[model samples]
Target chain A: MLRQLEDRYVHGLINKSVQGFLISNHGNDAWVEIARMANLPPQGFESMLTYPDSMTDKVLDGACTYVGCTRASLMEDIGMFLVTHPDLEAVRRLMRFGGPTFEDFVLSLDEVHDRACLAVPELTLPKISLNDTGVGQYVITTQWQVVGAISLVSGVLRAMADDYGALVVLDVGPHLHSDGRIMETLSVFIAEPEFAAGRSFSLAERLA
Target chain B: MTSTVSLGFDALDGLMPMHILIDKLGVIMHAGPTAVRLRPEHDLLGMRLFDVLTCVRPACDGGFEDFRQVIGQPLKLQFRAAPHTRLRGLLHPLDDGQLLLNLSLGYSVVEAVSDYALTSRDFSHCDPTVEMLFLIEAKSAALSESKKLNARLDEAREAAQTQAETDALTGLHNRRAMDQRLCDMTQSRRRTEFGLMHLDLDFFKQVNDTHGHAAGDHVLLKVASILREETRANDLVARVGGDEFVLIFPDCTDVTLLDTIAARIIARLEEPIPFGSKQCRISASIGTTISSLYSEPDPDRMLSDADTALYQSKNAGRARHTLFKDAFEADDMVAH
Candidate 1:
């Protein structure tokens, strides 16, 4: 995982969750305490682009313990946080330009991840593929995962759909593959008919 | 008889037996009644054995077959019984191609009680492993803290030693440090040839009386800088007294080199140093002594000889260098 991503999540927690909680909530030392709980050296999380995935996982676990939240909930909150965080404004803009409608953006998650890989070359992002099962129903499969934060992807999709004003219903599952790959599949049903129709309309408009 | 045995087994279930039964295909065949009661969130029946428990010892390699190979042997395994609870246990095999995992709490009882909010009655009172873990952790933390403090103390001590040896105003070696250096060099087994030059500022008292002590300090600092600039890299310049300095040149035997250095220092000190508004003029009278010419070269004797030569230069004409050997030859002529 990228330290830039870790830094964003830590800053988000300090500003949002850890605010008014610590007695001496002054500087980065509070975050350093969280890192210490995770069995990392003090001041270990420097401004590097990539770090060991295991260390990041421990740090996230430590953050959850500090905030009195479960791992699943913390991942969801971090995903939601990244959407609106000013430091990640470029990422939000990139997600917006993925497609015109919410369905297009959801379907083009793999492309967005591919672009993300350009920024952090060592990132082992999940491969996302969308298969249209039926009318307004799409099966999104995320495979070849490294870090166990698939819940964060679900939270990000939820926030993205809300941003585009598209109503979406999601059914999430950890469908294990025969090759030992844990594929997180999300069956999304776009409730808004206009948003479903706008996917093709926006694509046509772009083609014109 | 069968009913009586079943009733006895059901009674024993209240004691919380820490064991699990898994099939060769890595599926949980059955869980002990105690294990079930402790880990309610985990549905042990039909769940993947590797998903519920991790093999820590004997090297399971995360493969079902690898884990199956170590079923008969005693092995350590970790079970994800609960979110906060850490379960470690030994694995044994049953006769019917099933594995039995005997479990226990993995962390210190003190930590477990605080973190999981459990009472002391919940744990076995005689388990020394918990106490040992706490002791080891405390010892490790103390060792690391001490190591950090020692590192900081070492840095402070080094800085203090440097400050003690350095002159505050001119940033040159002080008299005490120079004496130590001379002592060390004289006592060395393979003592190389060396030269010492004693320099005293001429008309320095007049400048201090007329221009004030601040101007005199400025002139001394300027003279220190000139002596340092004229000397070689291997040479040492020390402020030994007020308006008095000494230069020690190691591995130097040539008299001409010493003459050149002395002349350069005297010439450089002749230039007027700028005080606040007016300029303070000063000159230096230097005396030279070589260690190679003396039998049993001694630092104290060399210093005394250099001082005598400096007095002769001061008495003759100021702003000149007098060799100790020349003074000795003049004394010999008088005795003849």
Candidate 2:
């Protein structure tokens, strides 16, 4: 999420990801219905632009209603889609740059926002803080304008764990902070570091 | 502790994965595991170091002492292989007068990676090359997405422009489009002779007043199709008013041709159009003028002259065509 001088705005990349997830997982007709329900044009979101925060909220709500799921789950699905979709392999590669292993990636959570900003300067992802509670457990927290930021992070973590052949469980919930800002908390536990043989990753891509 | 410590080959290999050890004769004694992967088909143990790598900077000869002179200085070298991958490295002196050269693929890391099919394991964990590769992929992806956005916006803009220039009810060129075409043809540097015709429906008001606006709309649609059928692909036919249409024919200034076109259009309009169960009857009056008739072609004057001839046809009795020159002469005859 990134805003201009005054008004809060969400980048079109996020909305476009939502649209891509819905259209590819569901169908184009489902996306059309959701867009119509959201009072948006059937053309859907453009990935290089920006829209008002209210419009994003409406689209999320409309998608939740259409998909018969909670908004958090939909956002989580979108996060996984961003990583797993072949069309968005660049996102997966970027997340892989966090570290070599899933545990290293979890430790690099606090730097995710800075790394993303460096990659795409306008995309100001939420800042995350992680606390290593025990040998295989961690507590992650963040305050963002978007309600599903933590849920999306959980989904990305889950997908990355699979990418690295690790097994992890994730739990997410929202709580009110003393400063009156709504903050989300995600609890993570690594069940098995070596769950399965992971997909092989090369530092450089081969041209066909 | 000893004043000078000796390092083992395994320790050096682990510390610098791309390091190469050369003897006093400039022959490679040992290469790090990652360095050996560069020339997998050829063993580097007995090969001349200068034969495999050519020094690109610091102006050095392919000799042992020349390598010794540039030990701590910055070095640029290139592989003498097909891809000619470039390398940056530093050289240090060993206790046995051998050279320990640690190499890194400078900007050619991308090419070398793809050429060698190297993975993250090929470099040390502290290496930033993988992160750089990630940034490159991310930026390119973002750039491609923006390019798509630009293309889509351009398409949307062109569609909006076309919609703005079209008449909603009949899907023909609107008045704005007609005016633009008229101005363009009249003011063009390579002005070509063209015929302008102004036409008005003869009994359209009576049909609208009798059968209601729906029947009028049906008759107008039929009229539009007839006009389209009567025009060439390059000809301009526009709905400029409720009951008026303007047609421009480029390179068509012959009066007889204009008259024939007008007659065919009038005959087509005279046919009854059925809206539901009611047959709506309508006719048309046409006036013609040519750009060659005026000393300097002007859009406003031509339209006004065509309108004057159309009104003359209306007064002379409906469903007839009147040439502007003929109407002007007829007015002269009346004044005399």
Candidate 3:
């Protein structure tokens, strides 16, 4: 992502999420091996710092080699982890605020980047543009500095469809452009709005 | 140009689920759907409006005339029942000679919602209350995440700093840390005094040549333990080189105490350190200087003086201690 920006730096929050996904799912030994493979310090990435974009790429590449998975699958897992992890329930709750139904959430994709900016001013999410072709169909285009974001968006959309009890099929298209800013396309098809009962949500949480 | 649009009771109830309507005689004619749920134990119709709600604001009496005085103005009311839920609204005089009061939970919306087990369906669609709730939840969650991030960042920073200032091989303060401490003590505004020592191993190279680097590491570790054991907790000990160390005792200007400590360290080092089947033997020569010897102690001068005294110990013989002042006096005698 930093290749397109003047600073050429990726925020540590993104790197930390990758680190967290590796450690929690693959264990600390795996994370240690991957960090060592990437020539990172023993303490691994800190969540509040920034690193070179090349370093982020190196870590992701190292993770792919160590975990024995493709880059697209790994990015997708990280996306699902952010939305569905027990420790990150706050993230799921915030997403639920997109609207009452899954279709509302899809239509509100364009505003997701701005809403995220309002929450954390430093965060740089991909700018999403949704093209509604027909009923329950959308051509979602995401523009960002990094290429893997489209795969991640597909993962999030899949999880959110389940969250809203909407059965949907998602197909991730390849990168449309590779220069300047990377852009990718996704096709979404909602099969059933009420496929199953979803988890309940309340406006007022019973905070302990 | 003004027109009046009449709404049916059901339509009014659907629009404002918490409204209250009273006749000219201050009798409760109708209560909105949600208002009826506030006090489900008692029926609302035919009861005096003032009997169920206490007008806590505007100093209104329990009469239609008093209510009319505050018409078109904001009203603050509380349920006369137990748990006295507070409500904020405005009182308006209807054209049919009655009073209409539409109410909503104000700042206490969260607690009121929980207290009543209210859901989104209970409020009108146009109400901003649900949006307010969403914002509150989202901001709190973001605040928590930011705090966790901050905490982890702080931990990482401290760990990095500790690693930077620590010697990886000996687990002792490195030269950088020692230099910082010395600079701090000398540059302090207070009349701070301390005793500094320069100690070098007598035959560490021989041990490495005789055995191997592993044996040499074992001996160094033993020497570090001896130094730590002989010094006080507040004292600073650093490995400035492969076989050279620096020790600083803050607020300690007694040359005799420092000499005793130096002798103890050398004696402990002389004890043979066992490595595999071979016992590695080593000793230490130390030079001491007290900060009180200089008018304004400078780290560079103090270090040089200690080094000069250490060389004196080396010249006199190995495995001994020398004071900078004593070395100077001996030089004076040699000149004579």
Candidate 4:
């Protein structure tokens, strides 16, 4: 089933996908190829920009398949794009205004979405809650009636942590609730930068 | 050339989403259509922002400058609607020199309904996070209830086990518990040295015959208390039979110590026990045996040998203790 998303985010996703594909050495016509693979007409993605809402899953799936990357990776790329995008400066400013620290930014994600809805009334943002499991450990839960795009939220969070230069370990899984809404839980362990660096080296050695 | 879209002030006000407009002085200038619907009775237009609502997060000091500094930042504010509600939003600076307060429910919708006594129909169908929050809350409550039930069950089991091992009349360990203690002691290889003293009260039946059963029970309680006072904390004292008791002393094999203990118990038992309007004197004949003298220790054999010594003590004069091995050696010498 297709998940409906606000047109602004839909346009933003296409632009970022095309740019990301080109940066990764994919051809300039990657957008066209992805559109064709998703069983849409040529240049159909361009029409979604003016519409109030559009089906999001087909575009995301085609982009993932063409780039030979998982949905999570693509979403992460889009999240990073949102932070760095030139035309989305206002959105970037709003996000940076979350707080002075990276943890504060993470905590403000739900409020950020609430503000974003003022400009785009059609936006259906998930509710995000953070539980402090222990020192340097947190469990973030997102409950949404919408079927997809939850991974995009996760990507944004990781990018936010990166913006602060904080090293973290993340694990994501879906918990199905009786109310029929999918609750995505993300377990995060914020590691000391030095310890994270050491762990990366050890992991590399084991892989080798 | 850029064309500016204009609506009349009232038309613009009607089109606005959930918001409140506050002037530079932190006074509410206008309540948007959605905000008015949430709280219709209150006249919020002239009220101070701090008087009408409270800042919940990114805490402010309730000052005008503090409120201004929060512009363009995500915030949580609780509005004093007819029914109170918390809203999450950001402050936007409008061209007309007023701040627009855009609001939406910051928490789970189900919790909002539960806390505010609103119905499901009150909330839009877009978000089900409220339902999910309710599920989580229910699960936590169930887990706490299960833990309490398990604790209660454990307490009841412990109480039942205690009742099974205790003598109802004397509050001492009954014959069954004493047998179990003997088996445990004999089976333990670490406890090579042990002593058992078997005591039988002389003329105990005479007091029961003269007085009622209540007096008999009182006398037994008194004896049990005295035995508990005389024995060490590590020792076990049990009422093994009517007018008969046993004391098990673990990790002790000194004959002299055993004899001293037996003598003390005899002297204590010989004291006058006073019932209502009557006084009775009783003495105890005790038999002592130590485990170290046996080649292979057996609980049953130890008990039987103590009983034999007790029989000798009863036959000798009914007021002293007889050590089984000592009496056996004396008999051998006489036979020689």
Best by DockQ: 2
Clashing pairs in 2: none
Better of 2 and 4 by TM-score: 2
lDDT of each: 0.66, 0.86, 0.84, 0.68
Residue B199 miss distance in model 1 (angstroms): 1.3
Write the residue-wise lDDT of candidate 3 on B162-209 in tens digits: 999998888889999998998889885764799999999999999999
Lowest-scoring 10 consecutive residues by lDDT in candidate 4 chain A? A199-208
Q: Residues A17-102, candidate 3, lDDT per residue (tens digit)?
A: 88989999999999899999889976788665677777877888988999899888888888888888887777777777677788
Work out the TM-score per prediction.
0.45, 0.88, 0.76, 0.40
State in Å the error of residue B334, model 1: 3.0
The alpha-carbon lDDT assigned to residue B61 of candidate 2 equals: 66
lDDT of 2 by residue, A20-120 (tens): 99999989999999999888899899887878777888888988998899988998898899889998887887788677778988988898877776777
Candidate ranking (DockQ, best to worst): 2, 3, 1, 4
For candidate 1, give the lDDT of residue B200.
92
RMSD of 3: 5.0
Candidate 1 Cα deviation (angstroms), residue A86? 19
Per-residue lDDT value at A123 in model 1: 40
What lDDT is obtained when candidate 4 is compared to the true structure? 0.68
- Which digits, one per residue and each the tens of the lDDT, describe model 2 over residues B35-121? 988976265788988888878898776776788889898999988877788999899988888888999999998889989988777
Off by more than 4 A, model 3: A1-85, A98-114, A121-197, A206-208, B1-3, B9-16, B25-28, B33-87, B183-193, B205-217, B274-280, B291-301, B328-336
Off by over 4 Å in 2: A1-7, A24-37, A65-68, A178-181, A206-208, B1-16, B21-24, B56-76, B88-102
User: How high a TM-score does candidate 2 get?
Assistant: 0.88
Q: Who wins the lDDT comparison? A: 2
Docking class of 2: medium
Model 4 C-alpha lDDT per residue in residues B47-119, reported as the tens digit of each score: 8887777787889858877778888888988865545677787888777777778776665344454554443
